[model samples]
Each structure stands twice: as C-alpha cells, then as structure tokens.
Target: MLAVLVSLLPLVRVLPGCHCQSTNATAAITATTVTSVVSGSLTSKVGGYAVFDCPVPLEYVTRRSRPLVIRWTKNGHTVFTLSGGSLTTDERYEGRTSIVEPPEFSDAIATSINVSSLRESDTGDYECFATHKNRDLQLTASSQRPPLPSSQPLSHQSSTASTLSAVGTDIVDAGVRIKLDVQGGDIMSIPPINQTRLEHESVHFSCVKEDLESTVQWYKDGVPLDDLPILNGRFNVSLEGSLDIYDAGLNDNGFYLCRIMSAKGTFSAGAFLNVQYKAKIVYSPAEVFLAFGKPGTLDCHFHSNPPLTKIRWEKDGFLFDTYNVPGVYHKLNGSLYFNRVGKEHSGKYTCTPFNDLGTEGPSTPMDLIVQHPPKLIVVPKVLYFRKLGDNITMPCEAENVDNKSPAIVWQKADGKSLFDPRVTVAGGNLTLTGVKSEDRGVYRCVASNIAATISAETELIVEESLFHQKNFGLHINSTKKNIVAYWKRPYSFCTVWSRDTSLKLSNWNATATSSDGKAILWNLNASKEYEIMVSCREEISGESLFSKSILIHPKVAESDQLSLQELNKSTGPVTDSFDIRVERSGGNYNVSWTFTDNSRKDQADVERYQVKWYDAFDGKELGTASTEANKRHIGR
Candidate 1:
C-alpha cells in the first residue's frame, strides 16, 4: 500500500515552508509538483474552441504509484476533473468540455481541457490543479504534540493538537494559476445621431453604450475632429462620449462618425449635423396704381439657406388663384402679373415665402388701385316738344361717377350755360319750368371726372298756344247746278279757297274773301270731288291760323241723264253729311272731318264709321281711322 501511494504522488515543486508527512512510520509521501503548458491571454472568434494544457514531467509520472487526479477550474469554479484515468466534467460544462491526455503522452503525464464553442461568458481566469496522496513518512510523537514547558499549564494541550493537524492537510494540497483570455463576440454598436441648431446656438451630440466596456472617439467629414487645428476651442468631446459645440456657425455642419473599440471588436456609426438659418425678405414690391388696360407686376424677393420650396400670393384676405381675375397669373419667383387691369383687379396684395424648415419674417402688403374713365349708362331723349308755359325734364346717368354731386352739367348748343333758376339739375336730371320760346334749342349734357369727360345732346321745340277751339263747324250745300260752303268763324276776318283735288287745279271763281266767314261757289261740277280751305288772320300782325280743309261733292238727281261724252267719264257717289280732307306737313299728315245727319228714315243708324284716305296718283288707300263721333281729327 505504501508503494502504490508513493507512485501516485505527482512530481511538483513545493513551497519552502510546505511539508508532507504520514501517520504510518513505514509510509513516506513526496511533495506535489504543478506545471503549465500554456499561459497568458488567448483570443478566438465566437463559436470556436480553446485548449488549456496542464503538463507534468515524465519523471514524475514514472515515479507515481497511482494515477494522478487532474482538475480544471475557471474563475474559482470546477470545470473538469480526471481521477484514476477516468474523466468527470462539471454540470456547467457538460457536453461542450473534455479533458484529454493522449495515449502517446501517457508516460509524460501531459493533459489539456478543451473548452468547445467559446462564448463571452467563458472569458475569465482559469486554473488547473494536479493532486495526489501518499502515506509513508510518520509524524513524530513530539512534533504532533510538543511537550509543554515544565512550568506551563496542561489545560491548552487540545488546541495545540488541532493546529498541527490543519498544518499537515494544507501542505499536501497544490494548484497553479493559468490565464487565457477568450475574447471575440458582439461589440457595442452606437446608434446614428442627428441634431439641428439655429445659428449662434450651442449643440451637443452623444455616442454612448451602456452594455459594453468601450471608449468612443468622434470624426467629422471622414477626418479626426478631436485635435483638429481649425476647431481649437470651439468644439470638444466629453468624457461620456459626447461632442459639444459652442456658438456653432455654418462651418460646423458636416457628417460625423462615432467609433467604438473594445477587446471584442470595433464598430462605427454616423450622424449628420445641420446648421439652420431663418428666412429673410430682402426686397418687396411697393404700392402701385396702374391705369386701365395697362399691365402691372408685383415682385417679392427673399433669401434663405435651404432655398425656398414654395411661394404664395394673397389679395385682401383671400388666397389668390388664376381664376380670381382674367389675365392674372403667378410666376415661379414669387411675383404676380396682370396683363390688363380693371376695377376688379384693385386690392391689397401680399407675398408669403415658405421653406422646408418653416415660414419666417413678416410679409409686406401692397395696395393696387386701378383708374378708369366714367362710363355713361343712360342719356336724355334726343328730341322733345313742349308748348309755351309747360315744363320739360331731361335725365342723364353715368357709372363710376365722381364723388362730387354736380359731375354733370347742362349747356345749350350755342355754348350758352343753362344752369339757372329756371333750370334745376339734381341727381343727373335737368328740369325747366314755365318754358318759353327762348328755351327751344339743342342742349348738351356733359359729364366730367378725373378719368375722362363726355357729353350728349338733345333738342327741344316750343310753340305758341293760340288755338283753343276743339271743333270747327263747316257745312256745305251742293246741288246738280251749284255748290255753296259756310263756316262758323273762329276769327274776325278770313279767306276761303277751293280746289279740284282730282285735277290738281284751283277754282279761281270759287275762292272768296269773307268778313263774316261765309262763301259761295259760282261755278260747280256735278259728281266731282272738291276741297275747300279757310284761313283766319289777325288784321294787325298778319299772323294766320288755318282751319281743317273740307271735302265736298256736287251731285245730280237720280233721274238726270247725261250726254254720251259725260257718260263715258267715271264719277263717285256724293256724300252729304260727312267730309274729310288731308294736308301733309313734314313726314306726317293731318286729317279732319265734319259730319251732319241727312239720311231718310229707312236708312240704318250709324253704329260705327271709318274714314279712309287714298294716294291721289296711284289711287292706293294709305290709311284708315275709326270713330263713333260726328267729327274727328287724325294725325299720321
């Protein structure tokens, strides 16, 4: 038994104060020895394996009486163990671990623990211990329990024996520390950073990772920004991996990168820094007044860093569009143009500038006033007739008239101003009361304003009121041999004239001068149409007023017979109670009639009657008049 235990003791270098002893006097134990085959750090990619070797010298294996116990531990935890040539692994490293000692190296006592599929958690300090036991040398009875001094007390003897036993157990246990770093796994990945700051504003950017033990460095535009000479004092990086800028300007804008490096790997992320600026209006249009039918333009000039994306125009409080007015359109440069301006085009205009960032600055409004001439909508009548001591009225109207009430004026054709007490003008109307002959002339109405002046003319005619009688009693008696005519005198002295209308010849003998307004015909024609006219004159002034002409016919009795020459001539029936005569003046003709009942009892009563006139040369009927009275006057 002693020899077998002796052979199992591993050869190892012992510490100076460590000693091994056995309880049996014949059994002797040798000191254990530990050796390392691999040491220091070892790095490998994730999902790979690493081997840690613990080698013992061949001389120690040959001298061993029993197989050594080999153990592998990581960070103070058991990983694998081998005893009596049998391998046992801890539950933590079950399938992915092995302790191998090749058959070729059996005598050498070299062994290794293979850690398969290394992970980040496997990175730590590792150690291996080769332990063996033997029972040969004996501990002297005096060494186990030292004799107490002759004068010392015996009560502390139990404590001394327990101390000796602990010292012996420690001397036999031995181990070696081996360090191998198994690194290579996921590293910290910084997220992208985007920051914006206004001009002259401070900004900060951070690249931090809480899950990794790493240090971060920043770069700008693919260049190191930490020690750049250009950013001497304006920029800095904080201990927590933050880059801060003080009073940033346009020059600080660029792409930035944050790089992180650790024992595992290296990773990088990028960020874009932007310096913003507010939009400003450099120039704006001024107030303008465009004439009618003239073109106009309004411009709004602006400046911005990111450039303007859109621009809009407004009129009054409404948005401006192409349909707002004809010939109006917008330009890309924030300007509005009008091909032709009118009253509807007049308004307040404003331009709004916008960008991707936002709208900035105040807009200036402009006023547009369109000037146009006054247009006449209504005018007075062209001709007006009025009797003496009558009133006359003329009206004129205009659109877009001046603010002043009296923008219209009335004047005569002779350039005589007619604005007087007799003529009142109000609301574009002119009225004249108690009109006389002097007021008979062409008058003009003139409208004037700041834009333009226009005028219209009208004529008025006035006549004296001398004739007052409604009817003239004219009667004619005719027979087969002679004809006579008389009338109730409207004036003191008058003259009578007779004519044959069919022959267009005057009857000189039938014409007479009458003081009592009576006349007789000496020569007469039967079954012939004759017209008689009477004129009444003032003896002093020779002013004359004519009565209506009378149409008469002299006829023979029903039993009368005519010669063959007279029978061949055509004649019309004689009318006894009704007479009609027409006299033409200007474009119109005046017709008058007088009637007296002379029919027999059997004749029908006149329910209605119509007077007709005919053209003398063509014998064509011109017009007809209907009346129920005995006398009528018609003007056509």
Candidate 2:
C-alpha cells in the first residue's frame, strides 16, 4: 500500500519511421534523453504475482532502425536481455518473468515485465537500458560528409546522467525501485554506518548473508544502480553478490542499500558514502595602474567543499610573499597592501588559491604598470631664418617613461597664452605662418599626463630674408573700362603683365615709362576678360619678383577688388589713380579719362586707349581661338 494516491500523466515523443540513427536525432528534440529519471515504489503479497509497467521511453526501439540490444537489470546483473532479435533470460528470472508486449516493436511500450509466485525474496532496484550495435558503422552511414578527426578525444566519463552519451551510441535507461516486505523486513538498523572515500577510488557494498541467493540487487539514494551518475559498465553486480563501483567520484557519494532474498524472507540495509574534494577560486587580482608613491592593493578570494588551508601568490613565476618583500604587507582579508607603489612592483602577477578539499583556477595573469610623467626626447631649434611672409614650424618629440603617453600643447615660455591665428600645435609640433618681427619669441612645447606637467622652450628669431616681404603682395582695383595699378615705396620698376603679352613676347611688349611704382591701362573695353599680374624689383636693373596672377572676368567689375578692403587697410600702400569711361552715340563710342587724387594725372593723359588697343581689340594682332584659350588658362 502507498501513503497517498497521485495521478500520473504519460507524455511520449512521436518518432519518425526507421532510419539507422533516428534516435540520435531525437536526442536533440526530446527531453527523454540518457539522463531522464523515473522512480516509484512497488509492493506484492506473499505467494502472488506482481506486474510492473515502466514509463514509456518514446522511440527507444524502432523496427528496421538498426541492430539493437535491450537489457533489464536488477542491481547490476542482467535479468533479461534481447539483442538483435535474440533473447536470453537469467536462470532465476526465466519462468518467473515475461514481457508484456511482442519482442519486435517493444517501441510501442516501455520495458514492462511481470513476475509470478512472488516471495519476500524479490526486493531491490531494477533498471531498463537499450544499447545499439554497429556504432561506428551507424554513424558513418549517416554522414553527409567525411568525418573529421577529433583534436581532443571524446569523453564518456561524466558526473551527470545528461552527459552519459557520446558520438556513435547512446545508453537509455529508466529508474525503478521494488520492495517486498514479507517478514524480517523492519529489522534493518537506523543511521547505517558510513562508507567514506576520496575521489577516483573504488567502493563496494556487500549484500552477503550465508543463506541468500546471488539474485540480490543494490540501490543508491533510492535510485536504481544504473541511474547513478557513474552509470553503465562502471557499476557492477559481482558474482559474490556485492555492488562494486570503480573509479569512484565526488558525485558517487550517496546513501547506498543492498537487498537480498533469503529462504526465510527479505534482508536490506543502507550506508552513506562521504566524498571529499578541493577548493575553487571565485575572484582574484586584476590589472592595476597606480601612480608612484601611492597606496594600492591586490585581492584574492576562494571557496571549496573542504575549505582552503592556504593561499599562494606568484609574480612572473616566482613566489611573491608580500610579508617577505619590503614596503608591502599581506592583509587578513586576503589582499596585498603596498605602502607606496614603485617601478619595481610593475610586472605580471597571479594568485593560486586552495582549501583543504582542493584548488580551483586563475587561468590568466594580470598586469601592474607604474605611472610617471612624460619626458621630451629632442628639443626644438634655437634659430630659424625665414622670409618676412613665409611660414615656419618647430618640432618637439617626447617618449613615454612608464607606459603612459602625455598630452601636448604649443605655448610661449614666458607664460603668454597662444591665441595667434597662425599658431597651432599637433603631436608636439608648433607652426607659424606669415612670419613677422613681432612674432619672434621663446616658444615652448608643453606635455602633461596623470603624473606631472613639464615643458621645453627655444628662442626663435624672424628675419627679412632677401627682398621678399609679406606687404609686397600685389593688390588690384578696377572697373569695366579702366585698370589702375600701384605699389609701395620699397620697390622700383614695377612692370604690368597680361596673358596676351606672352604670345607676342620677345618683341613689342615694352616696359612702362614711369619711374614711380604706378601705372594705368585705360582700355574703355567693359565686355572682355583680363589676365593680369605684377612684377617688381629692388632696383630697375634687378631680377623681377612675380606676384600671384589675377583674373578679371567680364561683368565681375572689380567685385573681387573691393573684397580686399581689409588686406589693403593693413598694408597702407600708395593710393593715387585714374578712371576711364566710354560713351556711345549711334554706333560710335567716345573714351575719356577722369583723374582722382591727381597724384599721377600727367601719365594718364599721355596713355590713351586709341593709341594702345585700336588694332588689338579688333583681333588683327591676336592669334587663333585655340591659341588664345591655351595661353591665358589660369594654371598655365
């Protein structure tokens, strides 16, 4: 009789028709895997028959699937076996037990068995397992591609029922417990003796009592022997009637019982097996970056079943005991304390933690890098010679002292802020454009990092090399009909140029007859494009220095010329000129000059538009269209 009545629901997996490795594919879909467990208690009266129906193990045996082997075991001994259509029954179970279904499609029902003429003798644990034959051949036949050689060997040793199967073959079993209480049953003792052992050792639980038969079986923690985590072949029922477990493991420790059938009745007893193991780490030291002369700490923590007795530390593979080293001490809370971190303390470190039971791991080592300020590798130059308007740059390079890079800036050594438009610093380099005398000073490249800030300075002197100067640049202001050009006092023989002048070069192009740096071209032509530039020399006979060329497009009418108002305001060059206008009457046009400021009025009256451009504008002296476009192209 049972303590209470409970309704049990049967949920089974629907499998496909026969294929060699169909069950292996089901392993991925169904939860009724190798480790699936089922446990229940059964009772039978004296001199009567008992029938046990196992929970359905879906698709465990499919007709036409493969060569199959089935076994029904009590304790670790086979009570009945069916292999590839061949059936064998253990001597004591031969006529007493019979299968509930036909042997062919045992797939429709779980491993169900019946026993007749039940005596008090049949009390123990029973397991149902199915094994497939031709393992390698079955896996090979199901391959879509050639199998690759495994780098690491496959493992069959596991600590849980879920991991009991590997490639090629699978072991499926059901959990069952049977108890027959005829007489002398309640005589077993309380709090049975303990069978304690270390990991990986062998253990035995004897069921021998002089008059008992060899049909005895074993149970562990109320689970059938085959359902224990050790499972399969490692669990054996010896001929002398003892439960033998090989290569005992931590998970194997549990309450074990031995049940025997004697001439009088059933005898059973149990004992607890205690297993001991080592400790494991939970947290340890990590990479740390601490400035020199600062306090810091490293940590280590662990856990274990038996608890750890000691902790070890290693630095670059050598013992690192904080108590043995100066300026450092070990803390009671399992941390290393540093009085002041120094360069010598920077290196890879690892923590090895262990308890009395055992030790876990610190797979990777951590690093400690000491921090310090950056240092300059090379200093900037003391003197640099640059033309008054040319650009200049200074260099400053630095190297990391303790694996930390520094932030850099460009500044004046005299603590002056760097607000000049021409000054910019990048990667410790300083640059200045349009160099002038007032721009001269002691400039510095400053570097700062977490540790400290430092700087390097150099005195720079700017000189007016040759006759080149920033103010010497050309400026043009013109209308559609007239063009006036003027320059400063320091230069002489200022010559005007045009792209048309290059084509008839070597001949008619003559220098302007003016001694002062001033000239005017009064063309009275508003509908033409002009390409112009200026060249001047320190003396009339000196080599001419050229300025950037200018383009006056038709309809623009000095729009660009008025845009230079700010630049002209700063240079303050000579400002005297004349303008020319054209008046048209019935297809005839009149050209006239109007002088402004009157500073160069005498030169304008003599240079009239009719005497200079009468034949040129009419195209008599110009070349073909291709020649004109090619000669005046801006980049040319």
**135-198 per-residue lDDT for model 1 (tens digits):** 2221111113221111111111111111011111112224544444433335432243456688
Per-residue lDDT for 288 in model 1? 64
Candidate 2 — which residues are off by over 4 angstroms?
A: 1-192, 209-222, 239-241, 258-268, 277-306, 322-347, 353-636
Per residue, candidate 2 scores C-alpha lDDT tens digits across 42-140 of: 332322333343332334434555465556677778777756555578776544455544344234432334454333455565555555553311111
| TM-score of decoy 2 | 0.24
Best by TM-score: 2
Scored by lDDT, the top model is 1
- When summed lDDT is taken over every stretch of 10 residues in candidate 1, the lowest stretch is 154-163
